[model samples]
Target: MIWILSIMMIIGIIIFLDTWRGIQTVLPLSAVEPLANDEKVSVIIAARNEEKSVEMTMLSLLNQTHSELELIVVNDRSTDATGLIINKLARRHERMVPIHIETLPSGWLGKNHALYKGYQVASGSFLLFADADIHFEKDTISKALTYMKAQTVDHVTIAPDLQAKGFWLQAFISYFLYGFSVFKRPWTANHDHSRKGGMGIGAFNLIKRDVYEQIGTHEGIKNRPDDDLKLGQVIKQNGYKQRFLSGVNQLWVEWYPSLKEAIKGLEKNTFAGFNYSLAVTVFAITTILISHFLPIFTLFSTDYAVQLLSAIFLIIFLALYGVTIVKMSSYSLWKLVVYPITTTIFLYSTIRAVALTYIKGGIEWRGTFYSLKELRGKQHQ
Candidate 1:
């Protein structure tokens, strides 16, 4: 039992190290560079039912510091005012083009299909695949463009400010991202050029147009619920210099409306992230339970011989989360401090995701039901 505890503590420390070693930006977005007119940037936004965020997001794009850019928004059969808002933005901003997605064709997820449609119309040297919910600082596009040019990478994705904050919202909004970053950063920063180990946050991704074609866009990852992960994998497999822009200062996106919405939002992604694999789901659940929360139950040692080990794990979790929180913004240190509860909520969300993906095989998002079985069936082909 003591040996098991010691090994667990060691593994936790390794996670801590990987996180620290891989991240080039603590906050994920304070870096800035200016875009030049030598190359034009085309920003494509895909909206399904983003009535709440569309207005602000459009306004932010219109206010971009760089004038050598065009914005195209694809309204993907939204049942709400999402299409109307895009039309309004097109009228308001000469640079904004409103593209209508007639319908979701078979075998394509909503966002990817919209992006592909948008991509067909964009004529810029670089392509920015941004979510409808993402609102940015006026200078965001130019800065990101300049940053990418300097990095000499084919694709650069910024870790944006994830805005949502009931205790649970604050806790897990970026947990998936944090895990993704830790897993891939070490190899990415080293320019390893390997066929594995690279990832990105999809809210704001900048890609060279040529690379986008090389990877095959939504068609390449049509069956995957987690398109962002597929994008990263494709980038690495093709030996491209995939990157992270840690300048999260002016990058902000609210993922959910309420606490319940927040929890459900993560549950959907987590379920799909595991590829509906039962073994991986069980391992993830057990690891989170025993490795992260056992200190509270004091199960490692009644005599508490492993007190040092417990403290180490907690501190690492705290430090990484604390740094990530600081990058998100200093709005509430108190919210970050309650991360233990937040982590428990996250664990719950993960469990729910697993159940929905495996048992129920149904994923509900913005009033649509996506079945894991159907998705897997497509993948096997």
Candidate 2:
């Protein structure tokens, strides 16, 4: 009876997660068409060992159909020749402004510091914070800016096309982005734009200059995951309007190099979100096991009816996963066959993130070792 109750609960929760996924934000996510007068914009590229993608990003930004713009690339003390690449781009394009990071004060996190540094030199009314890995169409930025202006949104962000190159990389990233975003209701991010709200990825975000300072931008969650869902919340909670666009055709970002790279990246902030509390951590783990793994238990049961029901539910989950992938990116329908494999990676990453974030001090990013506790304290800093 107890086992039956658990299975029923899991089924109910899965249904709820899937339904909530439909409640998307009603923002202006029209197709990417060039804005009539969308100029007077600046692009800020933050990099540290991004030599591979920096040049392409510059060329992409330069080719944008917008006029009267400045592209500032801040090389954050990269040991690689990332700076040289930036300088080369600047030399080739008169509008490109390649700036070396002067020095970051002790309190600031690296990306936030680099971004703030870039903002210092920007003279445009609108500012774009794009990752070094992202590539966009000629009209992408202009179209996005026009939509923001038309809707009067202080901040606008589009979910980038998650380009998965490896099998496991495809498995894990698709689950986290498409599956998780669908489940987490990231589209309706503004409703809970506080510490309790969903986060915005810094990659491919366009914001008004005034609103950036009003909410303190990354300053609110600087010590935590600078990329934590806080930026959206900060904008929403502070009374600035914001929206998430589903423009898969217009923008794309390569999240990481390999599955190992992806794991290390998520490890840093898995615990960073939980305030490092023991009780919340335990609850989270238990919830994940129940909601995601309980169906596997159906195999050991003798009841034919229960087994059949569980199988049906699992198949429904696979369909949803496939729908998510195709909607968010250009993955084929046959990829749905790998749902179980993908979901397992998602479960494992969350569990691994919890263990490493709590048992070990904190996961490493670049070279910084920011502890979970240190991150929470730094939020107020």
- Candidates in order, TM-scores: namely 0.90, 0.87
Per residue, candidate 1 scores C-alpha lDDT tens digits across 57-141 of 8888888887878899998889899999889878977899898876677777787788888889899989988888887888888
lDDT of 2 by residue, 91-178 (tens): 8888998888746666566777787788888998888888888888778887888887787777887777778687778767777765
Best by TM-score: 1
Off by over 4 Å in 1: 25-28, 174-190, 299-304, 327-337, 378-381
Instruction: Give candidate 2 misplaced runs (Cα > 4 Å).
Output: 1-30, 190-199, 378-381
lDDT of each: 0.71, 0.71
| Model 1: colliding residue pairs | 28-246, 28-247, 28-248, 29-246, 29-247, 29-248, 30-247, 30-248, 31-247
Rate residue 123 of model 2 by lDDT.
91
